[model samples]
Target: MEHRISKQMIRKIPYFEKMLSHECLESKENKVVLDFDEQAFKIILDWVERDYTIILIEMDYAFDLYELADYLGLDGISKECITYFHKFTIEHLPIIIPKMAKTTKFMTSGALDAFICRHFLDIASSFSKVNRNTKKTFWSKFPIETIEYICALDLMINSEYQVFDAIMDWVLSDSYLRKCHLERLWKLVRWCHLNDKDSSNLVNHLRISAGFEAKLCSPRKADCDCVFNRAKQNCFVMIETLDIKDLRVKVLDNNFKLLVSQVIKEDTSIASNFFHDEHVSDILFDSGRRVIRIDWKQNKYNWAPPLESYAGLQRRIARSVEYGGELYEELELGEDIANGFLLLESTETFDLICFEGKHLHRFSMPIHEIYKRFTTLNNCEATLLNNKIYLLSNKAILYEAHYFL
Candidate 1:
């Protein structure tokens, strides 16, 4: 059936040629309906007439244009429409900011500081993960005033540790050094003390004027005493570089050994899962303390308990299961007896697969003897590989299973 356009439809003019080409209207013989605001409809009809009249409405209907453009699949029109709206939004920010600030004032200063700090730090941290040119563009748009404000806010709140770290990184960078000002340096030092408990090192590192050096250091016994004495006084314009090779060497050795122990523990726990299954037959090896069982029926598989049960088992075991380089979410077993796989029985199964930034997963399982096995299993690690899950026990033995959903 033919649809009649009302004479009052204002949008019918300029948008007519464009609307007719939409895929939604391609089958013209079929019944069609057009919905729009009464005022907008009238303006459209006015544009359609011989007179090329433009209507300026007080209401900035930018969002409406975007919604309509996207809904109609007007790719070219959508871009042009959004571009105009974006310009309008930017031009109107002065009017919007005060209104937003008033409504947002009830928000705690700490919370606002945290929100802004997180946003800026996220932008800074994302640099390495994106393309090099994109990283440059991101930094270019991020104003120095915004960075300074974030740094100042961090100093005021003294809660967000990552923001503090990001600010310190900027302070230490060559770019920051080139643009360094006395006020900025003072603010940085003040912020360092506010956020970090151990600011002696950072305070000592600041490049201050010789006259201000005394203010940064502790007063001599002969001088006037103040409770808030500076930690140290030597502030030279040139920063001293320390040889970090020895420190790096020590950290590497200790860290490597710790990592190795964690791996072995996780592997042992995963291996122990072999014993949990009653279907397994034959103990292949017994060292009095630990026994290795063989599951001949379900294909040859070996099992043994993990070496030790420690507090850091969850993280260590997860790394071990992912040693072959698979990604999986780590789930905390709420009760002593809970099954991990049973939790993914619902439609939202994808949420169970942990990705970076998602640290927690909650799921329920039926009470069973297997649940007891889970409680006994310490340092539990789990990962999804090739659509199957590999869970490691406290003793570092691995259990292979599949996603129920």
Candidate 2:
């Protein structure tokens, strides 16, 4: 009994209607028939039924079928087909490459050359892993022109250190390929060091190239500690203008006093005394403005300002801090601070009072709002989060809660 596919079922198969068209199915009498086994025919039928799914074809079939399908121009396939075929082309290289090279006259222009080079590189890489048998096989089949092409392609496309090592091995084995590979390698090295400064490995590879001795040196010896140190130093210098010590000192001198004073106002006297040293600038105060004299050191009672005095000085400071005690009742009712000035939790909202220096001012919005407005208007980010609001600008000023009332 013969297995029969109904016309209706065949019609339901994707691409079957197109295949059944006279232009596709009709065979010319004079045309030579390409032999395909029963399994190959089944694969073709599956390819047709699947509506030429690129991923499926790539995963399921051999490279030759994939190439044929790609050449046939099934919609939504190109790069993936090339990439998939690339793997199989590498795997069955020994059989495929020599055939193509012998029949180069019949092959498409540059196709044989590309196949030869790609397989030569693959075989060379394989030889590096196995014994002399593999090495002899690779050497016997490898063409001089193909070796040079592999070296060129390796330099052009291979970014990984391991791949580079394999290519370099092939390069150093032959004098002609070595010189050509070196020329390409030099260009790649210079491009990596000068243009792509982020490629630390490439820079390291360049250093390896300088000291590499093909006969005696192990490939792993390419990782020279001294070269890495030099590359790291060069990388550091390229990106960082200031020394680490200078950066630390500047950052500490800029934000340290402000952070300390904001967190601990009771310890303000210590910071104040520290700031009096000629080298230390009063960062808390506006630059070029005379420091206000507060007799906190002399009077024990004056260590903390009265709430009434704080209220009086609210307008002098740019921002005010709210003690947990003052907002405890409001917070308990569920209100969140917003825009630096407004506090909204559940149903209640209120504007905050911000103070700059001795002046107290009622802000229509929160400190965050004022900061956003200032940043938007000036096109800059200018909020320092500490115990107090530290206004970072041409003239830095620390706004304390006591000053804001």
Candidate 3:
């Protein structure tokens, strides 16, 4: 059987080069015989010749091909296998990982294992008996390496009790057999973060394994999720500043560091004092249309589209704007409420939300009495959503204004 594979195909494969260099092939008469799996070699041969689409390759087929590539010292193909597997497993893991969890051959790839841990936590929580009705979980079926990898990602785990519950549900699935991994898996749980009730329950389950509460109390390094989560803060951007006599919006990061000063319009004096008054408040980010709506009193609204927005993502604040130009324009809602205002998209009436003194009620709406009760005052913050007014105060949400029959 002439395989017809060229020398170029094997050039990058070190194992075959070694065999030829050492004259390991059996020579009889005028021919040489090199023994190997014909089918595996055929697949590898085809792959070496650029014969197949990389994305369409099946996981199991790719796995077998990877093994053969590794054995044959096909470094190029082996590297491609790893990069593809990392992507394939993420997209296909919920269907494949359950079966792979019990197989040691598939568990050793560090990249595959780490991707599993990061994306599979929420899916794993569903198997915790309380979240669903299942006798067993894919989480419990995972190999020791996977269990440790999952446990190590504390930052990704939203609630410690969820992990504890998942581990408990795993052990309880079939304690006689599943408990075999408990001794190893229990050590990885972040016990200190659990509530006392959960801690007590776990302690009871493990008995002497949890030697002391103080033992697990040492804080581990926070993961990227934890660090990035704390980076969030409320940023108030000023629409105008006196120093430059130009319209500017200053952005501040969580640390109060000046990120950038966006020039909204060149000359602020060209516009009347209405646009520059310090009394101006409230801004609504219209992510759907990539526009920002700023309001002052109830007379009208100023609008500007973000400098960047995407087809499937929320828009961010625009870095610059030209007042009264195409990107920046004004919309008049014709109301007198200065507290705050929200525009109901594609609707005629604007829901004017007003707040004075200590008490606030969304039902104190003005559709019946015109804009008289809450006429033109500057105190509350407001936003429009689904054509309803989401009223807000400095510390908390006041209420969502709704019209009733």
Query: What C-alpha lDDT values do all the predictions have?
Result: 0.34, 0.32, 0.44
User: Where does candidate 1 have its weakest 10-residue lDDT segment?
Assistant: 258-267
lDDT of 3 by residue, 1-405 (tens): 566555545555677566555655321132335455465567767666774333234565566666777787766777776655543322244445444444334443343443333334433532223222343444556555555555655334445655666666666666777666776666666665666787677777677543433234424555412232211324656555445433567668656788756654332223221113333322434312324333233323344432221100100001111110111112223232344222222121123333443333342112233234454333445665554555554455466554331
Model 3, position 37, has a per-residue lDDT of: 49
lDDT winner, 1 or 3: 3
- Using TM-score as the yardstick, the better of models 2 and 3 is 3
State the lDDT of candidate 2 residue by residue for 168-263, as single tens digits: 554566745454555454432223222234345555654576453322122236642212111121111011124321111122222233211111
Instruction: Put down candidate 1 lDDT per residue, 245-361, tens digits, no spaces.
Output: 111111113224321110011122223321133333222111112333333233333334322211112121121111111233454533232333211222111112221222333
| Candidate 2 C-alpha error for residue 116, in Å | 3.9
State the lDDT at 305 in candidate 1.
Answer: 39
Listed in order, each prediction's TM-score against the native is: 0.29, 0.23, 0.37
Candidate 3 ranges with C-alpha deviation above 4 Å: 1-64, 67-117, 126-137, 193-198, 208-405
Q: What is the lDDT of residue 128 in candidate 1?
A: 22
Q: Give each model's clash number.
A: 30, 30, 5
Which residue pairs overlap in candidate 3's backbone?
Answer: 336-376, 337-376, 338-376, 338-377, 339-377
* Candidate 2 deviant stretches above 4 angstroms: 1-15, 19-39, 47-63, 67-73, 77-80, 88-90, 98-111, 114-405
Quality of model 2 by C-alpha lDDT? 0.32
TM-score (C-alpha) between model 2 and the true structure: 0.23
Full-model lDDT, candidate 3:
0.44
